[model samples]
Target: MLDHVQIADAIAESLITNGVRTGTRLPTQKELGESYGAPRHSIRKALDLLEKRGVLGARQGSGTYVLGQLVDYQISSRTSYNHNVRRLDASPTIEFLELRTRQATPEIARGLGINRSARIFDLYVLRRSNGEPLCLARHYLSEDRFPTLSEHLEVATGISDLLRRIGMQDVRRSNSSISARMPAKHEAALLEIPQASPVLVLEGRNVDAKGVPVEISTSVWPASRIKVHV
Candidate 1:
């Protein structure tokens, strides 16, 4: 007569006590049910709940596997995704979702200190750690400063490298703002998390050596996969 919640809690406890590392595949639903003295339906429900909590991932046709631990993200004036992930002893990667030039909106213009009608290079990037999607970001840069930036930059190199390649080696973070909210449908899909899951929003501007605003970006991180430290 064990409830699914109780079964899930017991499984979690067993995982901890048995030193179940990340990527360790759990037993089959039937096996788990037999071990816990519960039905297969209850065991499946328990695994589904664990998957929602980011504790496990259930692959189609494959069994559920542990998802290991969350990454500790340190917020600071000098923020670097690569550096941050490396500090956690993990590999970092970036994927470009968008890259194009368009007329700046009022908000984008204000953030980059450009005219509303000015052309801006808009880049949407997805960042990952240890092959897991961590966040999605949209960055805006004034096209006038780096006329050929669109041709030179690649998602793999990131914005910092792009600035350096364009002779803006001394760029630094000018300001930042942080907030929290549930993810949008598209964003949740990209992050591979539930739509009801919360995300940490970070908005910031970077300035060149002369303190001229050079770039502005907004990034959204899955709340469950990151521990933000100020």
Candidate 2:
């Protein structure tokens, strides 16, 4: 016997096992229903569940399809644009506009999981997705962890890969705190959106497989362009 959610999980499993890329047209609802021994409504319910997870898409006249592009994610557990985009072989370029060593103020300390006055790497970046401006981000990393961040500025493209080179394999295990608000003037300018556009702000630390904070990231994105798939 199988529950509906399990059935949906099976569909997800099948999609992965079959190499279904994003944008693959899914089986029609009738086809799915017949194959699963379920009714169309039940099949639709499963598909809807997948849609909300940023895994599927619906079109007005074209039925349902696979959502190929990875969504900006915020599960209660973890999320990162770097890990998200890799599902499609896309990579984010980090402009690395600034990287400085600074004394951690109270706010910075809390954000970086460090004691007050500790030295930290303050990093500013522009994150681009497929060559379009996606976010403006700031990162704070305690100097004890990322030792040479201050002396170098070579990271004009991609942080996750760079981290892997530095021996951090799992960039997705990071703790994330997220919120949404209307864009501030500065944020609007940086992100190139209208002042009225809502922006989602994400702040968190990228934890290594050992659960250490490897990268601290803050990101902002216009509401109209993103869907939270958690």
* RMSD list, candidates in order: 5.7, 8.0
**How good is model 1 by TM-score?**
0.74
Q: Model 2: runs farther than 4 Å from truth?
A: 1-80, 86-91
Worst 10 residues of 2 by lDDT: 68-77
Candidate-wise lDDT, in order: 0.81, 0.68
Question: By TM-score, who's the top model here?
Answer: 1
Which pairs of residues collide in candidate 1? none
lDDT of 2 by residue, 17-121 (tens): 554555678889899888888887788888877765446779999888876332444454455566665654666666777778889888777755678968987
